[model samples]
Target: MTTAIYWFRNDLRLKDNPSLMQACMAADQLLPVYVHLPNLEQETPWGFQRMGQHRKIFLDQSLQELRSELRDFGSDLVEVPGDVLDVFEKLRAQIDADVIYCEQIQAPEELEQVALLRNAGFKINPVWQSSMLDSQSLPFQMQEMPDVFTQFRQQIEKNKFRFAYPVDHLKSIPPLPAIDISSTQSLGRNTISTGGKFQGGEQSAHTHIQQYFERRLPDTYKQTRNQLIGMDYSSKFSPWLAQGCCSARTIAKQLSEYEICCGENEGTYWLWFELLWRDYFRFLHFKYGKKLYSPKGLSKHLGNEFDSEHFFKWSSGNTGESLIDAGMRELKKTGYLSNRMRQIVASYWIYDMKGDWQAGAAWFESQLIDYDVYSNQGNWLYIAGKGTDPRGGRPFNVAKQTLDHDPDEVYRKMWLT
Candidate 1:
């Protein structure tokens, strides 16, 4: 019988997982594996752990959930630590597999991994399966995509596009081929979750999607998405979506169903609109390649250089602005942050410190549990005016933001005092 390996990258779920599905189709038997690259633990260009505590806990949760789900399919996920190349080389020898399959990754190092694997005489099947719209259905070619979100949204509307269907229930298979391997070990991040819990996986994502739609949360999203407090204020889908625990297409399909029942509005539309922006950033990665990481980023000759000490202070929530401090502290304490708070803190870092925007992006990369390459980098670039935003440097007024978003000093005192 044919044997193949399916490598799990950020895309972890089986539901609407095109890469997993394609792997199943191509192999008579499959080995599902997750490789943890140890080098990411090294310090970033900025002096911080590349993966922070909150993100590590969330990732551990997501992987554990994936293990449980894959168990239902009569397969188990095998995790290996060290350089991805070394791990894969070891796996190929152990499994003696015919081919390897994985989802396409747009980031610089990730793409380089694919090239290295392909050159090693392994057949690599990299599939596109992350976004709401299928690559084939987008109004513009991925390379020719519009510069702004509105232009992209209008084009998508004018063309009358639709989302792809969710994958059908998976079929059971015999337990995957096992090889002699040691037990997986935990990776380190400074913080650990004590009583804190964040639900993970396709099941939890689906549950949240149902609750949000049933409660008509999307209808009120535009108004409350900016709210700085509470779980119900927004969809809370970012953590799942960021790690590919849920597919954006699946969310969009359910969204269409919600609009059919409760009716559509700017609020509902904005969610999809944001999804489009997500897609745009992914496209940007594909188009620009390593440009996203350059000092200039996607813009021409625009960047800031500031004191590293100030960045550390801002990162640790000791900046001394109540609202900004509260947000930064919350981010330090929890991997999550409200969108408004994210913008506020980012503005403080950029305009206040006069620090390089890339440094702030790197800080977010270290701290955020839900940091998606596209959203995290895209947002940092936008706020710093080095990416798609024509208007650079949005200097937030901290005093006004405190009065506006935390008028009672409740959120401020809760985090900052």
Candidate 2:
């Protein structure tokens, strides 16, 4: 009987997972595994934990939910903590599995892991399913893809790009080849209060999407998405989207249905526009590769300086600028901040505080439960004037932002005091 390993990475959910389906098709017996890499606890050069408490807690909740879902299909997720290479090496020896199926992550480190496995003589089949539009369906080839978001969006819209229909959940998965999991220890199993509005899981992701559409949230999304507070201000899909609890295509598909039922408006269209932005960032990583992680970023703009003191104050919500402080505090406390707040704080770090954008990006990577590498790096680069933005960089006036967004001081008081 043929055996294959379904290695879960960012793409955690089974529903709408093309890679998981491919794994099931290739093997009569499957080993579904999630290796919580030890690197998560290691510190970055910026001197912060790679994964902060907030993201760790959410990831734990997500893993638990994934395990429960796997059980329903007569399979179990092998929870292990260690180096991914080492864990997989042992699993391969035990099961004699030669093939591994997983999602393709374009980020440098993630790509490195796949490379290591492939070099070790394992056949790695990586499906590109993270974006709303499949790569093959794009009007231009990957290399020929436009460098700017506006150009990319225009071409995609002109070509009438469509998202793939989400795959259905498997009724039953292949039985696991029995192997000892005794050496494996669960990484995020400890119960901890998330203290955030969002919960992690495939079920929760779908439920949230259902409710958002049912209540016509998309119709008002354009207007309220920039708000500093309130659950209904935005779709709040990023955390789930970041963890792969839901696919961007699935969200886009639902939004299309919502528009058909409720009559299309600018609000509903804006949500699609935002999804396009997410797709753009993901594609940008593929186009630029390792440059996204560098201090100079895509544009190779030099002269960036690291200021530990400024970063510490900015990250700890002690930046002294009320708006910047409020946003940082909300992120520190909730593992979340509105999209508008993210831009404002990021601009303040890069322009106002004159700190290294890479340090700021690393801090966000450590903190955000919803942090996607592409968006995090892309946004930082944009703010630092080292990205694809034609305007060079964005500099938000903190005083004006405070006056406009929080004139009543309601948001400021809630987090500052």
Candidate 3:
């Protein structure tokens, strides 16, 4: 009996999962696995956990739901704790697997893991299925892509490229003999220092998506998307999308359908536009690998690091700018922040503090539950006038941002002490 292991990295959903589907098709017996790597706790150059609590809670919830869904598919998600390599090696010894299948990742440590597995003689198959528009359908090769986002977006639109609809099913697998692996053994609810917050999961993601589209999308998205107030302001899909509980294409598909049924407008279209930006960053990562994470970034390198005291003030949300402080405090407390607040705080870090942008990005990595490698790194560079941003440097005028987004001081009161 041929056995193949489907390792769940970021992609948690069963629907439209090309990597999972491929595993089902190629093997008679399937082992779906999720590895919780302890390396996530290792401190970066900045003294922070690589994976913060917000992201941790989201993944935990997503994995629970994914386990239930896979049970329906005549399979189960076996979770493993410890280092990824050790867990995989242990699983391989027990399952006698022929191959390992996972979603492709461009990030540094993730790619390194793939290399280690391949060196161990396990055939690794990674499928690219996360983007709104598939990489294969792009107008030009990633290397030959345009320098700026406007040029890239215009070219793609002018060419009239539409992404394929999402598939709701995974390929059927004949029930594989159950392995000795159990989720409890693989996933432990360890006490993580996250300033006392609960983790979010697939159930929350689904609920948020349903409510946002059904109740909130119609009235106030365009006007309120920039609002720093509450949850209903925007879709809040980033946490799910970050962990692959949902895909950009799935969200975009829903948006298009909603637009058609209710008549299209700037608000609905703007959501898709942001999704496109998400897609653009993913592709940009594909185009440029480790360079995206470099101190200099894609545009140019900055031989800079953060001032110890300045970084502490920024991370702790005590820079004295009420709006910026509020946003940072919200992130430290809740592991979530509105998009406008992210940009506002990021601008404060880069332009205002004159601190190293890399340090700021690292802090966001430690704090944001919805932190996707591409978006997090890409955006930091953009704010620092380093990435694909056209005019470059989205410097926030502190007074102007305060006046525009939080004139009522509602957001300020919530976070600023």
Candidate 4:
């Protein structure tokens, strides 16, 4: 019998998963696996844990839900904890699998992992199914894609970008070949409270989407999305989207349905606009490659310095700038912040504090439950004037932002106090 290994990376949900489906078609027996690397829990160059407690808890919960769902299909997820290559080598010793099927991740480290496996004589079949629009369908090639987000969005809108319907969830998956998982341990839970606002799982993700549409949240999203507090301010889809419990295409499909039922409005259209931004960042990784992670970034801007003292104060919510401090405290406490707050704090770090943008980006990577490599790097580069933005770095005036978004100090009071 043909046996294949289906490796789960960022794409965790079974619904709308092209890679998982391909694995099923190629093999009569499958081994579904998720490798937990030790580096995730280790300290970064900045002396902070690579994965903070908040994100760790969410990931652990998501994995648990994924494993349970697989059990319903008479299959199981073999979670191996170690270096990916090491675990794969161990698995190969036990089972003569022909190939590994998984989602394509554009980031450098993830791409390197695939290369390492291929060099070891394992056929890797990676499906590009994460974006809302397929890469092949874009009007321009990755090399020729626009650097500015607006230009990209206009081209897509002018040409009328279209996405394929999401694939249906499998009713039953092929049973796994016998393999021992007794040595592997599950991801550890966080002692930090999640504020009971977010839970990680495909089921929970779908429920949130359903409620957002049913309660008419889309109609007011454009107005409230920038607010500093409140659950209904935005769709709250990023955490799940980052973890792959929710697919971008599925979200686009649902938004289209919502428009059809409720009639289209600016609020609804903005959501689609935001999804386009997500796709732009994902595609940017293809064009820029390793440059996205570089200190000088794509623009090759120079003269950047890191101040550990300033970084510590900024990260710990002791910066003394009330607005910046409040946002930092909220993120430290909740593992979340509004989109507007993200930009403001990022600006303060790069422009005001005159600190290295890379440090700020790394800190976000360590803290955010919703952190995606593309978005995190892309935004930081934009703020530091190192990425695609022609105007060069965005500098937000803290006082002006305070007056504009939180004039009444309601948001400041909530977090600061």
Candidate 2 vs candidate 3, TM-score winner: 2
Please give each candidate's TM-score: 0.95, 0.98, 0.93, 0.98
Model 4 lDDT on a 0 to 1 scale: 0.89
The TM-score ranking, best first, is 4, 2, 1, 3
After superposition, which runs of candidate 2 have C-alpha atoms over 4 Å from their true positions? 188-191
Per-residue lDDT for 292-362 in model 3, tens only?
77777767557356788888898898898888888888888888888888888888888888888888888
- Tell how far residue 335 is off in model 2, in angstroms: 0.6
Q: Each candidate: what lDDT? A: 0.81, 0.87, 0.79, 0.89
Candidate 1: C-alpha lDDT: 0.81
Find the candidate with the highest lDDT and give its number.
Answer: 4
Clashing pairs in 4: 385-393
The sequence of per-residue lDDT tens digits that candidate 1 reaches over residues 1-417 is 788989998898888887888888878878888888876789987777888777877777778788889887878878888887787888778778848899988889889988888888788999887777777777777788887767877888898876667777567644477674347543434256711535656677778778888888898898888888888788888888988898898899889988898898998888988888788788778667788888898777868786878987888888777787888888888878888999999988888878888888888888887799878888888888877666764678988887788888888778876
Residue range 1-417, candidate 2, lDDT tens digits: 998999999987988999999888879999899988889889998889999988988887888899889888888888887887888888888889879999999999999999998888989999999999988778888878898899999999998885667888676789988887566555644465555488888999999999989988888898888899899999999999999999998999888887778899989989999889999999988788998777677775673588788788999999788888999999988888889999999999888888888888888999999999888888888888888898999999988888888999999999989
> What stretches of model 1 exceed 4 Å from their correct place?
185-191, 194-197
Cα RMSD of predicted structure 3? 2.4
Where's the lowest-lDDT run of ten residues in candidate 2? Answer: 181-190
Q: How far is 304's C-alpha from truth in model 2 (Å)? A: 2.2
Q: Which regions in candidate 4 have their CA more than 4 angstroms from the true location?
A: none
lDDT of 1 at 140: 77
Candidate 3 error regions (>4 Å) = 183-199, 216-219
Q: State in Å the error of residue 196, model 4.
A: 2.0
